[model samples]
Target: MATSPTPALPLPADRPLLGIAFMLAAGLLFTLLDTGVKWLTQSYSPVQIVWARYTGHMLVLGAYLLMLGWPRCRAIMTSVESLPGQFLRGLLLLGASTFAFLAFRELPLLQVYVINFSTPLLVTLLAIPLLKERVTLARGLAVATGFVGVIIAIGPVDWRAQPAALLPFGMAFCFSLYQLATRRFGRNDHPLASLFYAGLAGALASSIIVPFFWSPIAMGDIPLFLVVGTLGAASQLGLIMAMRCAPASLVSPFLYLQIVWATISGYLVFGDVPLIETYLGAVLIVGAGIYLATRRG
Candidate 1:
């Protein structure tokens, strides 16, 4: 009896794995963007760093618009007025970028990431009240778990304690607000248009404030500043593609893989060690985000 070698099992044809991989790659690049932004923060004002990032993103996005030909890019830029939800979303986006940059100046790269990553924790609760969804028992537990992580990350928040710890937390809240606003305008605008407007808003906002605290950017740091914007824009492009390929619930859980990239990059570049507490809190926050997004999905 010639037993035929067991037939090979077929790989799943679903693009879920591929989408996951794309998102993870985006996560890594985004972490790298953060690191570059944080490093530049050491030499320049936070406003300057933000200006570099926004300018880079605008330039990168503008290249895409140019590639689309003038007619299409004009169509996009002209059609922007129809998107109302972008106002608040733009405000929140500006806030997150501003605060996150300021926070980076004060905290280690990984620490800033740990805090900003908690936006979903705030979103889960905000979604219920704002979206008029039913808040189930499971979600309450997830939110509870998430805040506990926030407490852990904060350690004891005394007035005497470091103010830097609060920056990422504020960054998280502002970002959550931005996401909430996105849920409103997101239904109307094309993803590229929405992203373009975000870049425009950031550039406009930063342009005004950046002048106040401007230090002449040394020619040497120009590449890093440009890389921040380029990477940030590309990350958003990847997110749009990933979301289109798969539902967010499927993609959202993969976001936490950012922690791995951040930890590794932080160690290699900055020789930083994330405390066990930071890791623990990061897990809880990621767990909560997954629980809420999965439950709704």
Candidate 2:
């Protein structure tokens, strides 16, 4: 009797160094995208900015799909493991984007990034309930520490007096929920399909309301709009490549580099500088995030 043929081994083990590079690239691209959004917010509504972002994302993603040929494109289009979950994930990202745009309008980019860095801590807390994941006491303290950092960064301001200050927190919360949703429902879905649905949902939702908030696009700003979408798509693709090349644990910490990128970009483009509190608070938040990521990894 002929023996059964051996199954082919999966792709060679991940190249962690390369993954780190990809992660860094993704982070930089993301910072650029945010910079563009902040710049556009000077003249556009958040709704309009968000619509341009998602629309550009769809346009770029469509070109990518076409390059992969019709068969692969067809597969990506048909493969939806969970439509509702995908839709929810899309809306969460859209909400996060909206909040980020709003926050950028009201706060400096570095401050916005510092507040958003609390996302990992929020994700840990969210996981206990939504993902039914266990958390040790040490992790709990880290989460608390991260929050303390957020409070410090925000300073002792009355909430009702500065409602706009809350935008980044909303951004962090929505992003954390999006992360949890990806953990729950994305495992079995096609990567490209998931990417497609995310942009599709955002594009559709934003398109419906964008008309009401519309402003005529200046010819000079056309390139900026395209750049926003291109950067968004490129950054996402970089993230996907990073995950494929290395375990999340190996590359996750590199995400903190975004703080550096944001700080530098904020200074160069917008002439914003971080306060002493922002630095101190960033240390705590970044430290806590690194600790949690390493432990989980």
Candidate 3:
């Protein structure tokens, strides 16, 4: 009998550089989205703004699916391997978005971004239990360091006076959980399908409440709403693509770039200046995050 040809080994899945690029682009887009949300918070409730974000996400996703034709669209729609997981991911993200929008209404853009940087630390800790991953001593130290950074960034806030100061931490926690869910459930799903369902829960939840919060949107503000939605959808897709291309650890550090963008945007658009503590705390947080990302067990 003829010997069978040796089977080819599968190629490694990661493309770290490409993932970093995607992450960087996503960070920029997210900054723009946050800026738009902040601006809109002046005229719209967080619920209404979130509704626009997810509704636009669905619209953009629908248009793309339609462009791929009926068969492909149907396949993507039907490709749910973990419907519950997808829904949970959507809810977690919705919670994150709600917290973030609320924080934006009360806080400076840079401060909000800095506090949310604690997400990487939260993800690292949560992964041990949720993802069943091992954590080394170095990673543990890194997490501690990042936590210190968060405290420094939050420097001397009077809780009763600045109650909204706590919102970013809530956003970070929800977002960390969302990231874990995405890592667990996203691996086997089609990218388009994952993107669709990621926004679906938020869209439905917000739609139910948005009518109550509705402010008649101005014609000029229509474009701003559209931009918020489009940017949210596009940035989310970019994050999915980044995770697909590389491990989350590698891509996670690039998210710190958003702080830079947020600082610049905060200054230019709102004439806001970041405090010295914000800069110092951001440094520690970003450094710890980078360490946690690169020093794998």
Clashes of each: 0, 0, 0
Local accuracy of candidate 2 as per-residue lDDT tens digits, 1-297:
000001111136878889889888888888999999999999989899999888999999999899999998998777777889888888988889889999998789888888988988888998898889899999999999988998888788778988999899889988888888777766556667777888888999999999999999999999999999888778876776777677776787787888888889999999998889998998999889888877853
**Candidate 1 clashing pairs, residues 3+ apart or interchain:** none
Instruction: Show model 1 residue runs off by greater than 4 Å.
Output: 1-15, 77-81
lDDT of 2 at 96: 90
Against the unseen true structure, what C-alpha lDDT does each candidate score? 0.73, 0.82, 0.83
Which residue pairs does candidate 3 place in steric collision?
none
TM-score for all models, in order of appearance: 0.89, 0.93, 0.91
Clash-forming residue pairs, model 2: none
Give Cα distance to truth, residue 271, candidate 1, Å.
1.9
Report the C-alpha lDDT of model 3 over 1-297, residue by residue, as the tens digit.
000001112126777899778878888888999999999998889889999999999999888888999998898878878998888878988999999999998899999988787787898898999889888888888999989988998899899998999999899989888878877776577777777887898899999989998999999999999999999899987876777677766677777888789989999988899999999999998898778666765
The TM-score obtained by model 2 is 0.93
